[model samples]
Structures are given as C-alpha cells and as structure tokens.
Target: MRMTALSAVLALSVTAAAQSQPAAQALLDQGKWQEAASAGAALNTSAGLTLAAEATTAGASLVPDNQKKALFQKAQDYASAAIAKDRSNADAYFELARAQGRLAQFVGVFQSLGLAKDVKANLDKALELNPKMAGGYVALGLWNATLDSGGLKGAIAVQATGASRSNVAPNFEKAISLEPNTPIHRIEYANALLLQGKKAEAAAQLDKAVAMPAVTFWEKRDLEQAKATLAKLR
Candidate 1:
C-alpha cells in the first residue's frame, strides 16, 4: 500500500510539472522575461532550460547596458546547462547560439570575432540535432549575412568563423519553408536581401512580415521593427 501511494504521488508530481509548461510558455509569450526565467527555475526539463535562456537574453535588452552582459552570461550558462543535461536537445543549442550572438553584439569587433566561432558551432549543432529547427536555420543565415557584410572586417570574420555569403539565402529560404507562419524569418531574410542590394525583394518580404500575425512577444517586437524598416524602404 505504501509503495502504491508513493507511485501515485510521483505520478501527480510529474503531471503538475508538465502542466506548468504552458504557464511558463505563456509568460515568455507575454514578454514577461524575468517572470518566465523565475518560473523556469523550478523546472528541470529541456523546455524549461530553453525558456530560461531565452528569457535571460530577452530581458537583457530591457535592462541597462551595464547589466546586459551579466544577463547574457546567465543565458549562456543556462543553455550550456541544458546541453549538458541533454546533448540531443536542439533548442538548448539554439539558445546557446542566440545568447552568444547577443553577447557578441555588445562587445568590440575583435571580441565579437572570437565569439563568432562559438555562435556558428552551436547553430550548426542545433540544426544537426533537429533538421526542422527553423529558428536555427534563420540564425545560421544571419551569421552568414552579418559576416559577409563586414567588408575587410567581414573577410576576417569569414576566415575566423568559416561562414560564407553563398549559404545565406538558401538557409533563410529553408527556414521559411520549414516554418511559413513565422514572421521573423521573413523579416530576417528581408534584411539579408537588403544587404545583397535586392531592395524590391526586401520590400516585398517586409510587407509580408507586416501582414503576418504575431503570436508571441518576440514576434510582436520583430513586427514593429519590420514596420519601421518598411517605412524607411518606402
């Protein structure tokens, strides 16, 4: 009887943890980044770790510049922890790449160059783990695009990270194909198109992004950026 009771309690605990996932996701979707991170503290699952990493990185943008590095570091730590827990967790690798990318943005060109390898490696690993991970493809596309746009610095970045301009559009298109409803992919691809001097094509993509419905906090923020960029293009 005692063993049976213990098993029942264990099952209930598992169910409760599973139920909390939606609430955690809702917090993230609503842009309650700090809250989402806090909520994820109690969860030990891969989803929870990904949420914590994403929330930490997103929350960094809302904080003072001085606090940004610390938050990004936390995001990287959480993502690394997730990977340690589950090497096959594609989202964990994606979050690691994202956190590193954001951290690179705050540092100097030389520092960012060093981080480029890590960013590219994690993104690649994420895609290897899950071929259908659209976000990973988008990040990889951005990596290629950003490095190729740097001129002399871009050449150096290309040497350091081994990223190529040739891979950019194809990866973006793959991302769009994998997740057609995701507006951010369109916006990012549009940015890539503009980098390539394909103004008309970029404008079309931005228009499509503006018309798409944003279901999450990140998507809404991306939508606003897309609208602002579209205005500049027109």
Candidate 2:
C-alpha cells in the first residue's frame, strides 16, 4: 500500500511538471531566453532546471562579451542543480559543457585547459545518455578545432587537454549525419575548416549554410555570420 501510494504521487508530480513545459518552450521559441529560463526554473524539477540552463546559455550567447561570463556561470549552476536532481539528464550535461567551454575562453591558459577537460567529460556523458544528440557532437568538433588553432597556446592546450585536431572533422561529420538540416552545424564545420586552412572546403560549407532557410533567431544569426564569412572567402 505504501509503495503504491508513493508511485501514484510520483506520477502526479511528473504530469504536473510536464504541464508547464510547453509555455516555457514557447518563450524559448520566441527568443525570450531570460523569461524562458525563469519560467522553466520555476517548476523546480530536473527537466525544468535543465531547460532553464539551456535558456540561460542561449541568453549568454546573445549578450555582450563583458556580460556573458555571468550568464554562463548561471547556466552552469542551473545545469549542476538539474544533474543533482537527476543524474540521467542528458541535456543538463550538454548545457553544462556548453557553458564551461564558453567560459574557458575568458580564463587564464591553465584554467582554460582544465575547463576543457570538464567540457569534454560532460559532452561525453551527454552523448552516452543520448547518442542522437547532434549538438553534443558539434560542440566536440568546436572543442577540438578551437583548442588546436592558436599557435603556441593551441599546442599547449592540446597537450594538456588531450584535444586532437584530427577529431574535428569526424565529430562535425557525425553531427551532420545525425542532423543534416541544422544550418548552424554546417557553419560551425566551415569555421573549423577555416582553422585548418581549408578555405575552399570551408567556403563550400558556408555556401550550404547560406542556402538553408532559417527557422529561428539563432539560425538566422548563424546564417548571417556564414554569409559574411563566405563573402570574405569569395
């Protein structure tokens, strides 16, 4: 009788938690990142917290460089809380990795390299839990490419973090295989190719990205960036 009662309570809680998600998602779809983050976090559930983290990260991306670090830190905190609430939250892991990777750019060399390990570990965990997570693969591709592109700093980071330039193309290829319609992935691939001095190959990717129709504000922004890069290549 006690177990049955507990199960019923859990089911009710889940249903209630799910009820608020659609409205929060609507805010995200509208690009109201800060509002979405707050709305999702209000639910006080793991999924809600993860959504909050995702929104917070998106907000961070749109902010000025001087203002981004705090938002990313907030995202990391939300994602950590979500993971504490539920160990199997794949999106939470991904968001944590995303925030960490972005945060790494603002830190000292040793700190950035250390954060790279955390970023990779979280991305690995996310993919382990949800193998179809194309975004995780894309992030990994950027991780490899970025850590290996900065001359002496790049070399030191690669040696310290075990990041491999060879892994960049494979990761982006896998991401595209899993989610070919996402324009940002191609743009990211182009950026990675440019880092490799494959300007022609990168231009090819930018061309593809330019041809894709934008479905969201973020996609449109990526397309604009790609177009500018393509123009430079031309």
Candidate 3:
C-alpha cells in the first residue's frame, strides 16, 4: 500500500513537471522568450524543447543568417522532443513551423518556399486544434504571404505574400478588431495598406500604432521602420 501511494505521487509529480514545460512554451509563442526560459529552467528534454522552439521563433525575424541558423537549431531540438512526447500534439506542429520558418530565412528564396510549406502544414494543424488561435492564423498568413503562394504573382511576390500587403489586410484588420491591444496586427494592416498602394493610409495606421498606449518598445521600433519605408515611398 505504501509503495502504491509513493508510485502515485511520483506519477503526479512527473505529470506536473511535463505540464510546466508546455506552459513555458505557450509564453514563448507569444514572444515571451525570457519568461519561457525562466519557466523551463528546471525541466528536462521536453521542457528544453519548448524553450528551443520559442527561441527559434524569436530568431527567424532577424536579418542575420548566423543568428537565424542558431535559433533554428534550438527550435528543431525542442520540436523533435515535443513530437517524441506526443506524436499528435498540435502545439508541436507550431514549434516545427517556427523552426522551419527560421531555417528558411537562412536559406535562399527557393529553399524558403519549401520551409513555408512546412509552416503552413503545422499552422494548419494548430488551427484545426483551436480555430480561434489568432497567432496561428497570423503566422500562417504571414508564411503564405512571404512565399507568394497566397495571391502572389510575380515581381512583387515577396511583398505580396509576406506583408500580405493587399491580400490579407482584411484578415489583420479583423484580428486587430478581435484583440485591439495587439500592435502587431495593426502593423500588418498598415503593411497591407502600403501594398495596396495607399501610402498615406499606411502611414496613418503606423502613426496610430506607434501612439497606442499599449504598444511595446519593439512594436514602436517596427512602426518606425514602417515610417521610414513610407517616407521613401512618399
């Protein structure tokens, strides 16, 4: 009887430990890498995988290949672990999408196309699990836009697919309406306006995003970049 009680306690403890790793991963998904690192510090391989996946997602947006490559490796490690833990875990798909996206950024445009497809597959699975996950939709849309696979045609494919400048503007607008405080959504809408050849309208949205009381410092930086781009257009 005592052995049975001890075994039950051990099982509960292991479950709790495993659960926290995924929780850390959730924080990472929302661009909270530091928080995720803190949450996952004492965990095992699965937890480390969560941390690595978050790191990869954060790294892919960078302009440097070295940085992107490192992050992709980290994300790959965690995503593999996650898949090992639960083959059907939808969140693992999101991590894999992030990893592939980072790796694609490091590779050339042609390679990026394949990575974009992987991102779509994982993101599609994620949405299947939770249709209301705004981030997943945004990520998928961004991936599709980047590859010019969704409404992308020719010379302007990069802008059309990634910025979803004209094609997915309404989606970002809808996402913003759903969550007013998220500055990234507004920025996406601003980009869409620019893609639609509405420079002035895009600038206005950027200004509004920059002025938002809830805007983060990073978001403000993105707004400034948008302003610079718009200035060149004007």
Local distance difference test, each candidate = 0.89, 0.90, 0.64
Q: Where does model 1 exceed 4 Å of error?
A: none
Residues 1-234 of candidate 2 have per-residue lDDT tens digits of 999999999999888777789888888878899999999999888888889998998888787899998988999999999999999999999999998988888888789888999999999999999999999999999999988886888889888888888999899999999999889999999989998899999999988889999976767777888999999999
Flag regions of model 2 displaced more than 4 Å.
1-16
Best by lDDT: 2
Q: Quote the lDDT for 175 in model 2.
A: 98
State the lDDT of candidate 1 residue by residue for 146-218, as single tens digits. 8888578878888888888899989999999999988999999999888778889999999988999988888
Q: Single out the weakest 10-residue window by summed lDDT for candidate 1.
A: 38-47
lDDT ranking of the models: 2, 1, 3
- On TM-score, the stronger of 1 and 3 is 1
Q: Write the per-residue lDDT of candidate 3 for residues 1-234, one digit (tens) a residue.
A: 999999999999989877886787676656666566556644655546556566555645654655668668667767877768766666667778778876876777666766666677787787787666666666654554455433434344464234333446555655666677766666766665554556787777777666665443345566677667656756
* Deviation of model 3 at 92, angstroms: 3.0
Candidate with best TM-score: 1
